[model samples]
Target chain A: MDERERSEMETRARLVAAYDAMSPSAEVTDRVLARLRDDARVPEKKRKSVEPDSRSALRFGLFLLPLAACVVAAAILLRPSAMMPTATKVSQEEVVVEETVDAASSDAAVAGDASVEVAEEAEGLAPQATKSEAAEADAAAGAESREPLCELYPIVVTPEGRELRVGDVYAGKFDDVRPEESVAFSEDGKRSVACELIERDGALFVRYGDSADWRFAS
Target chain B: MAIDLEAVFRRHFATVYRLCYSYLGSASDAEDAAQSVFLKLLNHPREFADSEHEKAWLIVCASNHCKDELKSARRTRVVSMGERLDASLGATDHLDETIDAVLKLPPKYKDCVYLYYYEGYKTAEVADMLGIPASTVRNRLRKARALLKDSLGGS
Candidate 1:
């Protein structure tokens, strides 16, 4: 053989020699086969007091319950803030109404004799007075409530024409909102409102016409 | 019904364990990896189409499992100068050094060398096993031979 052929032959011989040398010890295969045989035998089914089918079904249901709860928690956690109803706004409205009614009734009770004449003559006037007084009370309550709203100030109108409301306590993409803007909204194929920008606490806020509080333009 | 796992084990255990031993250089690890290969076979026996398919699957699975264990252990098989000289004495002793050198090569080249030399697989078989083109396997083998020749002093 030529030198090149000789070199090729030597290389092949070396590889073959190496392969033959490294063949696993007989004990390795014996151990593995032994383990395999040991693993193959099915364990005897114990005579269970419980029905196997029902037990398995119950176990499966138990397993799925946590998974379902996790899925629900994840859904609740990952759910869009826009889809969740704003409890803050609803609660704020309720508080405002409660305060106004309480103040009106207290004033009516304190004005005992005056309230009797007022109740008689103002039976006609009573309704108008109550309506005007309620309106005035609401305006005053709204102004007083403005301080807390301005202090934290959750809602913001973005430059992208989307209203960004705080969905949770912390400031992020997802936070709950209490609406500070009270613009007339059209409920068509889309519910939308437009409000101008107002600044409070070094942040740009949104203000609908005649609204007492300023919302953040997020 | 389950396939005859014992018959499969009896037939392929030696080849599978030898392939793992070549890769890992430890009888214990080879046994462990080989057992894992059979356990995998037991769990998913329907994967094989025929006897030839089963053999090829065992070799590939054994090789892959050994590599994964080696990676997890953060162990690289580095043959020392003394070890290399010791390996050159006998074909079987030198085999670990050859494999260690092969493993030191890049993954593509290492696999080609292992499949071609240790498993006695044809280049086409190696290509099919690795899911690469046959030409790629040939090129890798050529590069691996050149590398091994250089490392083993051009012998």
Candidate 2:
């Protein structure tokens, strides 16, 4: 054998002796056996093989129960024709005929009038805003346009006419305000955003969120 | 089937512990690993084709467990300085230096070197036990020798 082969053999011999020297104590063996003995005494249940069950289907149905209810409620609340008086209904027949006659002359104007009626019906606003309140709103909207663009806050309105909440993004115009920047509405502007529009005294204002107040431009 | 737990422990404990100690480079960790291996056998029994199969299984399991332990964040946080191999085996002064050098090897090579050199296993046998290709085991052994030669410095 060459010198390198002999040296390799010597190195192997030394490693073997060193590793063989390290052995576990008797206590470890005893402890392991004791653990096994203790475990053996404990009763173990028979393991069941996995199989598909109807319980999962039942659980899935139960999970969807609330979602299904929400969908149905949304359908009823969001039906477009439900907001208008039913023409065929016995109670609203006369009102519907009157509305039909009025709609024929100014169908476009009726939409704006319908908003006033809804606000009144919902008790969200005072009755017809009187004549003085209407003047104030017009003054507010007029004064808002004269103000510098920076003074005005972007109010994003959905095509559906509902005012969107703060931080909600929609790609469309709300009156004169165009979709260019993200909209963030606020009331007090200190804690959290409140409403999109606010009426204090006779003046109407749009909250730009975070202590920013501007006249209602739309 | 009732296999004698005590007999198995007595016969194989030293081999298992030595394999763990060589892999881990720490006496405490070796003992813990060896105990865990036996507990695994206790909890889950398997039919061994022969005594060779049983020994090979234990070695593979112990090596795999130590490798996993070394991978843990805790092991990395605490660097392992080599512990004194038990003196009861009556190792000479030269043997101690060799063992320390082996322990200092990178983990990738250390286990293979230990199984091949210390356990008196052929390269093929070590490969089979480690679930690795024989060519890979030979490569590790060769790399380990070069590292050991450099570390030992003309020893």
Candidate 3:
């Protein structure tokens, strides 16, 4: 070997010798072992296998309550319109006739001395009553214009029984109503009663406001 | 499955303690760090993948802990130069002079010298253990040898 290599080897040897001569502490192993044993024994209670059944049951019940509530809330939000029914429909022609007759009676009552003259005029022109007819038609048209637009369709109350209709008059109550669905009334049934219509999930529901239940709107 | 802590302690305690002592140059700190190492093993016994892994981890952990203690001691001004010199000397005569020369060398050179000679690690193994490039280890070792030779009166 070269002198440099020899010198390096000698240095390594001397350092190793110095290290070997120095003794380690005698109690180090004992101290380490004691600590390990202490660690293994602590927390013994947490490792026990026999927990009480009642405590476990209580924990399980608590966990399931929130899960059950979440399922119910999801169901309600997904099907909001399945809660009510639609209102009855009123025809514009009938409303106009009723307003015309009422206006004529009021006019006769106010024109007290002219009442005889108006009645005579009414009788003679009852047959050729073109002028009166035109006046009645105008009056009917004005009354129809004054009626609320929401009164044309059924009103739908929310599932919480809150009124969902836009009109002031309540149409009717409905059962199992859903939002966005249309309701149809029977041919002979009164079409003017306020009905609650709930539309949900591409289907319409109709029910009367006074009733406790709803039917699918046809 | 839980590890056989007693068996592991019995098998490697001496080596681990010795490694810590060499790193810290103090018996008290070595013992404390050694105990801490075993305590850590007890808490998380499944960390080691195999026997070799466990041994390597213990050495690394103990070494790191000892270095931290040394840093704290220095910061607190509790690390007396005379005491360190005496501890490094142990039973060796004229160790003060030898260590003074070693200490005068740069820290990188000193680490290579101490691990190679004082700790009895091979150059390649020391390189792997310290996570340094092997060429760097070679250069440090060469530089330390030159410095030591000059200090020790070698031509």
Please write out the lDDT profile of model 3 over residues A1-218, one tens digit for every residue: 99878866777665665445333544546766765676577674542322347746766877888999999878986763434322222233234334544555466567554444443333232322343353344343343433322233444454558654333333344454544343333322433433445654445555432222455544
Poorly placed runs, candidate 1 (over 4 Å): A42-218, B1-3, B73-100
Ranking by TM-score: 2, 1, 3
Compute the DockQ of candidate 1. Answer: 0.26
Measured against the true two-chain complex, the DockQ scores of the candidates, in the order shown, are: 0.26, 0.32, 0.17
| Model 3 chain A worst lDDT run, 10 consecutive residues | A84-93
Ranking by lDDT: 2, 1, 3
Clashing residue pair totals per candidate (backbone < 3 A): 14, 3, 44
Q: Where does model 3 exceed 4 Å of error?
A: A44-218, B1-3, B47-50, B73-75, B81-90, B94-115, B118-121, B146-155
Q: How many angstroms is residue A126 displaced in model 1 relative to the true structure, after the best TM-score fit?
A: 70
Question: In terms of docking quality, how is candidate 2 classified?
Answer: acceptable
**TM-score computed on alpha carbons, candidate 2:** 0.49
lDDT of 1 by residue, B1-155 (tens): 13588888878887786666656655556677788788777766565788889888887787778778666523546634444333324544356556555545665465577678666689899889878899999999888888887776565
**lDDT scores in order:** 0.57, 0.60, 0.55
